[model samples]
Target: MINISYDIKEYRKQLFDIVNDGNVIVELGCHVGNTTKLILDKFDNVKIIAIDNSPEAVGKMEKLADDYSNLTFISGDVRRHEILLEAFRLTQSCDILSVDLGGGYHPDTVFKVFYIWSSTFKPVHSIIRNKGLVDFCNSAVVGCEDFKSHEGHLESYIDEGIPPQIKEFELWTPSLREK
Candidate 1:
């Protein structure tokens, strides 16, 4: 969800907390490499496969990639086949899948993108930074005592992952028995 914090330290902590021992990280949006840079610097062993739709300045990403031997930056649209193919060719899987497409990331976009990334990589952990996600988080009432997270959530599914099926996506549905 959107790192809903005004303080920079709190936001950074929230983002970095999800990542501890993960070395190979697939970052969906590295618009400026700010977060990517932090990640690379934080973990000495971090290898970031960062992608961005923008290659704004000439040699911007190329320079960053050149500087960091551990980094592999791909420039393209995530929804495109070429991008997907390139990502697949780079690495079939990663330890973490970090998606921060943008601050105003719509839930629909997040769901669609995460569906593809999660299904493909099957990372040990995954995280999204989206403003809209905060709404869903706040709307919910549940345990906050750290139920096994990330891939661990898969075992407990609904209990840990919260609702994979959100109310926002529902308009009508087939019923085994009418409501």
Candidate 2:
């Protein structure tokens, strides 16, 4: 299992409140299942689908799933829309989508995956009502760069007159929250 330094309990609590009980949850780049374990412990009723491209990470995640039956691990890349589509097809709808792809210090891969996922999955206003949350724990400079990139991209989409698919978006740093 991955050893995370931050206090994940608060994020777990926020997720629980946003998703309630018996909702489907999807996690991208779930390395070693640390956050996945926290989610399962906090929201036992919800079904969790965790994906990681690395075999090593998937292996770690599989070990973490050994005792828990509610969690399912998928070994695939989130960059592939088909993979995400297939996963979403299996679950139909997800109440929460946690994106924690490995983009430490630099976010080229993270930006690509987030844009693809956001474009592919149209937020179903009735079923998946809550806005998706992204947790990025790294250097302040890197986080700020990601925030600016996301903000600019989102604005471009808005300027194109694209209907707001995402109800709301929350970008969080280790200590501060960026709108």
Candidate 3:
């Protein structure tokens, strides 16, 4: 999932291209608020709940959140059930749910956690960090288009178009599933 063309600016543009006004964005791994800043800057009336494992990252986002009233920051590991529950309580459905949990875990493993947590409410679109995980997710949930950051680079995937909304969102807890 490494692409030389994967600059932060391009990443911001790609995210902005998919997200529009009034869309809720739940982002995993909000490192230093680079993407979070762009998201807030690009869209007005948008709600973004960004989470990161590091306190430093959250602190940085906290500084940025001061300027943008629509943004919220949560400091916790997204892989944790309680953290996911916190994110769920914040927003049930989002136009886009972007995830990049870093390289510590396998892409499949990361995708699985996100899938299980997000099973209740399907996002209108999703932006996954790895291409393989995107394929894996597409199998579990159909009709998402595979997109590349650059013309020939396939580091990520963007699930395009509108998806059906959920009436009752399902919430998962640690005891309910094996860790």
Top candidate (lDDT): 1
Question: Each candidate's lDDT (Cα)?
Answer: 0.65, 0.53, 0.62
Candidate 1 local accuracy as lDDT?
0.65
Q: After superposition, how far is residue 106 of candidate 3 from its true place, in Å?
A: 1.9
Cα displacement (angstroms), candidate 1, residue 151, comes to 1.3
- Name the TM-score of candidate 2: 0.57
For residues 1-179, what per-residue lDDT tens digits would candidate 3 score against the true structure? 21211234555556777788998888877878877887787678899998898867966888888888899888887766577768767776667777766535477566565554444335666665654554555567544776534321122322321122321223333332332
Give the clash count for each candidate.
1, 0, 0
lDDT per residue (tens digit) for residues 1-179 in model 1 = 22333233554577698666446788887787877778878887777888888767226776888888988988887765567667867776677777777757687777566656655566776777666766777787787766544471132332222233543322111120133
Cα shift from native, residue 100, model 2 (Å)? 0.4
Tens digit of per-residue lDDT, candidate 2, span 1-179: 01122235544444455565686767777778877787777776978888888877867888877878888888887765457656756664455666666535135455545544443333221111111222343432353443222221233342232124432322211111111
lDDT of 2: 0.53
> Candidate 1 vs candidate 3: which has greater lDDT?
1
TM-score of each: 0.71, 0.57, 0.66
Q: Give the range where candidate 3 is weakest over 10 consecutive residues by summed lDDT.
A: 160-169
lDDT of model 2, residue 76: 88
2 against 3, candidate with superior TM-score? 3
Model 1 per-residue lDDT at 117? 64
